[model samples]
Target: MPGYKTHMAGAAAVTGVAVAGIYWLGFYRPNFESMVCLGIFSILGGLFPDVDTDSKGRRFFYGAALLVDIFLIYKQQYRYAAILGFCALLPAIGSHRGWTHSWWAAILIPASVLVAPMVLLGLPWQPFVPYYLATVLGYFSHLILDGKF
Candidate 1:
């Protein structure tokens, strides 16, 4: 199986091609900030599958979750913070290369990018479509690298 660097590289390459294709096809014209956010989301998705194990990806995501939870708590958004904390523990529910590596997870997990904002902030889901695509493609790249796709 590919390691962290390998998975990240594969995801970056795939995301770049997909973004360029979308831009070339005039589907979307993303700004610099949007592009950067897409890249970050793609990379996180690439690393997401490994969160079920004792890997760097797990630590990175859990640490990020912790920071976000802390911020939510500071803002007195206890409900959101509690939800985040509970979700953060989900990766541990299954074994490595189990549900987290499934094709369904590749789609379902990243759906949070769209659903969370809409549910929590009452934002429209349309604007988040690019992020969802980027994350799903990145996750698929991981599965491909692992020979799971």
Candidate 2:
């Protein structure tokens, strides 16, 4: 299986290509803010799949998740904050290469993390579509690099 660096680089390449395609094809409005958001999500998604393992990935992922949950709480999004916190911690229940490396986890885990904030924060779904797609693509890149696909 590919290591974390390999997976991350693959995901970034995939996301960059996809984003460029969308931009050149005029699928998105091509704003700096949206592009930055997409980039950040894509990078995080690349690293997300390894969060279940007892490695540095876990520390970064969980730490980020914790910060996000705290921000949610500050924003008064109590329920979604709790849910995100739970999902962040959920993978630790399984051993490395267990559920976290599975196909289902690859899809659904990112979906939950991406959608929950939208639902709880009353953000429009349309703007976040690219972000979601980029993240999922990055996540799938990780899985494929890890030979899970």
Which parts of model 2 are misplaced by more than 4 Å?
A: 71-78
Q: Please give, for residues 1-149, the per-residue lDDT of candidate 1 as tens digits.
A: 88999999998899989999999999899998999899888988999999999889999999989998989999999999999999998988999999999999999999999999998799999999999999998999999999995
Cα lDDT tens digits for candidate 2, 87-135: 7778879887788777777677667545665777677666666778888
Reference-based TM-score of each model: 0.94, 0.82
The C-alpha stretches of model 1 lying farther than 4 A from their native spots are none
The Cα local distance difference test for each model comes to 0.93, 0.77
Candidate 1 has its poorest 10 consecutive residues by lDDT at 84-93
Residue 41 miss distance in model 2 (angstroms): 1.1
Prediction-by-prediction clash tally: 0, 0
Highest-lDDT candidate: 1
Per-residue lDDT for 109 in model 1? 96
